[model samples]
Structures are given as structure tokens and as C-alpha cells.
Target: MNWKKSLRAAGLVTALTFSLVGCNTEGSYSPQEIIDHALQETKEPLTYYGEYTMDMGEAGGKAQVKEWSKDGKRRIETISENGEHNIAVNNGSQIIMYDVVKNTVHKIDISKDGLDDFPSQRDQLEILFNTVKDTHDVKIAGEEKIAGRDTYKIVAKAKKNDTLIGDIEVWVDKKTWVTLKTITNSAGNKMTTEYTKLDDSAKIDDAQFTIDIPKDAKVEEISVPESESVKLDTVKEQLGEFLMVPEENGLTLDGISLDKGIEDRSEYTFNYSKNGQQNISVTVFKANSNANKVEPVFGEKEMDIRGQKGSVMDENKFRSISWQENGYQYSIFIGNSELTIEDLVTYAKQMTIVK
Candidate 1:
């Protein structure tokens, strides 16, 4: 239970408390109703400002965090009791992070929503609730007051197994549909957070996100996704002459996107649909950079893929196989689609390079 690890996940859960306050009705709220409101907030985005304290009991860590988001720009300031402070601002086009005490800045340029991956905070909350809604016992426990607002306490407990996200208890705002507080116990690791101040309707000054770099501050550069979705017909030209893609496909081609490379390098993502869902994707990029190559550990079995050797490994919920050929790297990510290593190897063998 390293609090540092848990602290990384807290920022995401804290997002569940950032929506607008709903009207406080006279009656109580059902677990389903509360969950629906949270899911709905995903579709309707809002501007918000909040400050909260996180106490990781026993694990021994605490921090004061403040958050603000308006339009597509966002900022987060975190301070520890020991006087350590960090401020990061994402203003659509780039991310600027500065260490106040150290006088150092790290900057990364990104397109609007360029680096944001799938399953947004709202989506993650929706998925968490929907996954346990039918499988677990969900009910509103009682009413409580938090952050000066009346809230309904909803608890969801697993029936037989303590696995699926363990048990969750959340205090939702009565007027503002946001979650004011939450306590989650997953496999014996319990985490709690409470918002001390929140204003979803706050008129946050845009200048708050703007940072003026000092003349003598040290600066470092970082890379991020600066690409957009490209049409299939235009992918070849965008890939330049050095890149190639898989020639064979059994599933429907959902779409293709290209990441503008930092150097003379670029990557192409070919997404394929299965059962009306995009379940398979192949990422082709240059193998020259260490960032693009995937090395297999020793004693690990290797597969003869397209006359070249590669290794297939379990990458979280995805089964990925990354190999290099013709000075380029190709990684196929198929959701644990019940595809055995042999099946994966066979698919790779059947692939023909299309220049």
C-alpha cells in the first residue's frame, strides 16, 4: 500500500466530484439514480474548481490538492505539509509544469485532446458503476452532510466475491450531482477523500492557468502525441516512404490514424472491428528509436512471425505482439479476444507487408 501509487489514482476519482450541483429534492435518491447522474455527467461537461485534502491512513501520506478546469484547459496544484509544491497547467495546446521550490519547468507540446486516451474520468466512473450495478448489491445507505452540502450515502457491496472492485461507498451531492466524498475498499486497500471547497459554477479567471516562466528557470522538453485521425486513402502518403502496414485483414477496418513523428519518424494505427466493435489494432512505426521497440526477456519462447521472430506478451487487458522488420516496428494489440498464442502467431504469419 504505497501511498504514492494510490495518490496517482486519486486525481482520477476526484474528477467524480467536479460536476454541477443538482437541485435538492425532498425525497431520497436510489443507487441507480445516483449512478445515472454520475454517468450523465460524462456526456455533459462543466467548468469547476475544487480543493481537498487526501489522507492515506497507515500508508502515511497526505496532501492538499486544488483543481480547476474551464473550456478544454485544466490545472492542478498539489502541496505537501513538508512544503513541497508542484503546479501543472494544460492549456489545450501544451502542458507546462513548474516546480516552485526548485525553479525548474518541464514543457510538452500537444494538440487539443491529443494525449488524452480513451475512457475519460466520466467514462471510467460509468464503467465502474455499470460493472457492479447488476452483479453487486447496491443501495442508498443514509443522508449525511459534507462540504456544507447535504448528500446521500450510497454503498455497493459484492455478493459473493470481494474481487470486482471490492466494495464502494460514495457520498453524492444533493443539489450539485457531484460526488462530495468517497471511500473505496478494494482487496483490503482502503482510500478516502473529501472535498473541503468546491464550486462547479465558479468563474475561474483564465489567468490562473497562465504561468510566467522566470528568466533563470531551467527548462526541459518532452514529447507527446501531436497527431490526428487520417483517412485510409491518405495514410500511405502521410506515412512517408519508410513505413509499411499489414496487407491482410479478416475483420472490418474501423479507421486509421497517424501520429506526426518528432523526427523523420511517424506511426500508423490500423483499427479493425470485431462483432461490431473495434477489438483489434496494429501500430506500425519506425523501429530505430528505443521507444518503438519491444524486447522479449530471455528463456521466453519466440514466434516466427512473417519470417521474422517476435514475442507475444500479456499487456494488462491486452495481448500484444511487437516485432521489428525492414527497419520498422509493428505491434498488434488485440483485446484478450480468446485468441491463443498460436492463433496470434498464425495471424502474424499470414500478414504480408504492404508498402
Candidate 2:
């Protein structure tokens, strides 16, 4: 495992822990008192709607989603050329994913309720009232300006047993206790989360949390894949595009060559132009490896070029990372490359994913 990525993820997770504590701690109030207040707030139901853009590390660019929610769960709907999909999730447990493309449904088991489940933005505000237990050192680093509003900066240190996450920094609204920015460095990748549109209040409905499973929807169990190494010739055959071998650290880089089909998919694929900066690679995995005679490709890991951490999709097995910026998104799968760290990051920065 990449300690940097693990540490960075720990940092982000620590920030989340503090965010939950902040919600439990009212202005100049005790953490326990704040949580009591938050529990009371949950009695009233609410919802919200907004636009969300997720920045997927080296995968490149941003993933845009129009959000809608009701009850206590939040769902994000994304439409790809294949079909529409919805990801319904709450922090630790209660994760529901729907793939209209394949017409599939998946659920997860969680020990506790996570903020990711809340349908209302107000729920985020209310969580500040709950528990204030920290296994490590935590401090309020004063305040900063976020979207014209004053926010409190909270920093946390690493714990002895905490190996995956190192440090975390969070920017929370001083007035509303809402998280304006969250930065986490885990597994070698640095992840940042920012929330906006607080000043504007809108109407949210209950239907957002409801899942009307299509009559034809297929039920499937989703889990991380376990695959070792990559085969060059097989990758070339799986991916419909021609691949060119790029040079880096004396290791061979297998990637998709620019072609007509790739050019055609560029529009719906999001941003493909700016990706020239990073060496781009592609891999095609068997969609139904568990049932049919299919081969799965486990992407390789390289060192970070921009000081960002490497990621573990499934405990260093079948994993992928994405990066988004300037209205574009790019994703690189490890099963697509066989280059060393220096060479991989050099080209990973050039790819993009758009839609």
C-alpha cells in the first residue's frame, strides 16, 4: 500500500471526523451539547438540489452531477452515452448505486449513518451538534474567507494506529458550521472537497431519496476485483483503439492511440484536448468476469509527479483514479499502463474525461 495515499486519505477522514464534531459543537458550546441539538434537528425533514462537480485526481477533470434529494439520503445522477446512473450514498453505510446503462442495483452495509446519506444541506449544518471525540490532536486554526463568508479552519494530526490517513485541513463556515472546503491526502493522492451556495436557500423535495427500481432493473452484488499485472497484447485487443508505446524510466507505456472512435467519443467523454500534458493510457476490463469466462485487468501504480498520492482502487488490486479541472474530467486505469512512477505521472497529467 502507498503510505502517502493512506496517510492522505487519513487526513481527509480526520477532517470528516472534525466536521462531524463541529456540527455537534455549537458556537461556544460543548461538543456534547451540540450533538444533542443536532439530534433534535433531524426530526424535521428537508431536501435540497444543486450542481456538484467532483475532481478525480490524475484521472483528470471534473465530473458534473445535478443533485436532488429527499428524506435523509442524497443521490447523484450521471448520464453517460451508455445510459443514466444514480449513486445514492451515506457516509459509512447505506450506499445505493443504480446503473441505467446496465440496469443494475447495488447496496452496502454500514455500521453507522454517514452524512453522505442526508438529503438536505441543512443536515450538514446539523451534524455539527453531535460528538466531539478525537483519537488525535485537533485544533481550530482560526478562520479564513470562503465564498465571501468567514470560515473556521480546523487541523488534525495523525494517530498512532491510524496508518492510512496522515493529516487533514477543513474550512468550515463560522456562522453556519457548514464545510466550505475539505482537503485530505491519502494513498498518495490529495483530495479536496468544497461546498457552496449556502446563502441561497431553495426548496428540496422528498422524492429525491426514493428509489423507484425499474421493473427490468437487474440486481447485482458489487465488490472490488482481484487481478494481478497487465498483459500488453490482451489490453490492445480489449481496448478498441490502437496503442502507442510511450517512453519513461526505461519502462514501456501502453496507451490508446488517438483514433476516429476515440475522437468521436471525446465529446461525451468530457475533456480530451488538455490531456496532452499527461501520458494517457486506456484498458478494457471484462464487465462480467465473475460469471462468464472473462479476464479482468488490474491497472498498475506509479509514483506521483505533482506530489499527489497514488490510490488503491481495491487494496492495490483493481483500482482507478480520476482527475477533473477546468470543466473537464479524465480517468486513467492501471490495467492500461506498465510504466514507472516518473513516466506515468508525466503522462497521466495530460489526459481528460468529459461529458
Candidate 3:
């Protein structure tokens, strides 16, 4: 398989594996108790080698993953589909990724960029637990046998039926709290993953977390650019005189971030917040010549914003509006706020070029 197909399959597996499970009424432990127990058990450092299979509705593949972590250092070795070997190592301060097929290595410094290191299994599980706690109703389904070990089955169903994830089910290893099997449904498509082999008690050396780049491999250094905060009056000085902003909205200017876009073009991002909670972002960049010819995604509808033809997409918990004006393409994103489509359209309609 090509790289893009491999990446798509990997993404599908990740989405399905972490999708939240649903609740049952017959288990001995309360849903919250089970989640808390699983969270607490993930704090320990350990090593595991496992073989797993991912089955999407239209695509399927299998891989072997060896993971080890201790004292904030972590490593993962994956033999993905088509026998592609990939290695990632994080030593608390930096991350190095190596691809065996391409014979290339890429390094990023976490400390200098103000970014966190690569996430470990415990971190992922904590995120999953928080997602279940905040958005879904979870229950301990029952017990099951996975990879020769007894496990607890948990299910989580989203309170909102229109979410991308319809429902999820997971079988958690009783002793380690690690997930062994996961099944998820999203938009009428189903995906499942199961661990065929697991060795949690393997002794791993600290050197296992380190990667030595080969002499013949090509090396690339990834740079994380910093954003500059500019005053509203200076926006026209940086961008052009044609950029627009809403003057009457309750949203307050958080900051403006400038980044490099395609072919060295400059992109400007405006950040706004309401009552210190609701966050809204607007991005403006040079519009491609073909931008007007692109087709909208499913469920998006054509609309008129400020007399410019645009598209509006509304999902379960998020909404966005995009349009091309003059020589720029602008997009506005509203995330998980109480704002409705009418509110978003009102905001869009009130936009005026800064004088």
C-alpha cells in the first residue's frame, strides 16, 4: 500500500480504538468507579509487545506494536501494514521519528517549542477517561477473555446521537487496565481491533527507548515557529487594508497569529474569546485560483455572507463558515459553544473592513 493509504488506515484504527464505549446496568461496580480504577492503574511504568488487527468496513490490516516507557521517556516500534517499519522515541525534551523504508529521520525539540513530549499510553487513557466523563454515559458491561486474560467489558454511548462516534465498546485487561479489544461505530460504519498477543511483564532496558540514526539515513530538523501578537490598529499594516472584523460582537480580541502558508505566503489568524470560555478563530490567506471550483463536503449548504457566496457546515458540537472575498479565503470556526447557526451567520454578516 502507498503512504497515504497506510496513514488513512492508521488514523481509522486510532479513531475506532479510542472511541468511547456505552453503559450497562448489571455490573457490580459503578461506571465512574470502573473508570477511576482504570485511570489509577495506568500510572505505572511498563513494557508490552502485542500483535493487533484492525478491521474497518472496507479496509483491514494487522500490525505488531512494541512500546516501552519509564521516567518520562518513551519509545514505540510499529511494523505497520505492508511491512513498513516505523520508530518513534521521546526523551522528555525531544522527539525523533525514523522511517525504515524511507531511511529518513526527523527530530523536533519539545522544550524550545513550548510543546509537550509525545504522549504515552497513560496520557491517552487519561484523555479517553476525561472524554467519557464529560460527554458520554458509560457502564460496566460485563466480563470477557482477551489474549488469554480475563477482562472487564465497558460500553459508552454518546448522549447526542448525531456525533461522529455513535457508540463504542472496549474490553479492558483486569490486571493492567490496558484495552485489549475495541469496537466502534461512526456514521453507519463499524471498525474493530483486537490484541492477539500481549506481554506486559517483559523487562525492558532504558536503552530501548533511545534511537540511533543510521549514518546513511537522511536527517531533517523540524522547526516550530512562534506566533507574534499584534495590536488591532496594526492589523492593516501587517496584512492589507481589506481584512475585516466584527465591531459589535461580544467576542474580544485574544491575539493575532501570523504563520507561513503555502509557497511562502503569509497567513493571518485572529483569535477571539467570549466570557473567558468560548473560543472562536478566523483565518485569512491568499485564495488559490481553483478555490472557487471546489465542491463542498456532504451536509454543507451554500449561503451568502456579506454578499459573498460561502458554505456553512454544522456538526453535532461544532460549526464553521468559509468564503472567498477579494483575493483572500476566510474561514471561521466556533467550537462546542452554545452559539447557533444563526448566531454564526449574524457574526459573519457584521464583518467590516478595518479602517
TM-score of 3: 0.78
RMSD of 2: 16.0
Count of backbone clashes, every candidate in sequence:
5, 69, 7
Poorest 10 consecutive residues by lDDT, candidate 3: 1-10
> After aligning candidate 1 to the native by TM-score, how far in Å is the CA of 51 from where it should be?
2.3
lDDT of 1: 0.65
Which residue runs of candidate 3 sit more than 4 Å off their true CA positions?
1-13, 16-27, 41-43, 54-62, 112-120, 123-137, 158-162, 185-191, 261-264, 275-279, 290-304, 307-309
Better of 2 and 3 by TM-score: 3
lDDT of each: 0.65, 0.42, 0.66
Off by over 4 Å in 2: 1-47, 56-62, 65-70, 78-85, 89-95, 107-137, 157-163, 211-216, 221-355
Residues 1-355, model 2: lDDT tens digits? 1222332333234333122212333356333333333334444233445453444354233444555544445566654332345555442345677776677888764444433433234443332211113433556677688767777676655453322333556665555454556665544455665554443255755556657778998876644322234444444444434322235343344333322222122211111112233333443222222333212222223334234544323222223443333322334434323334433445566433221
* True-vs-predicted CA distance for residue 332, candidate 1, Å: 7.6
On residues 172-244, what C-alpha lDDT tens digit does candidate 3 reach at each position? 7766666788886644457777877777666668787788889999999987655666666666775575665
Could you estimate the TM-score for every candidate? Answer: 0.59, 0.41, 0.78
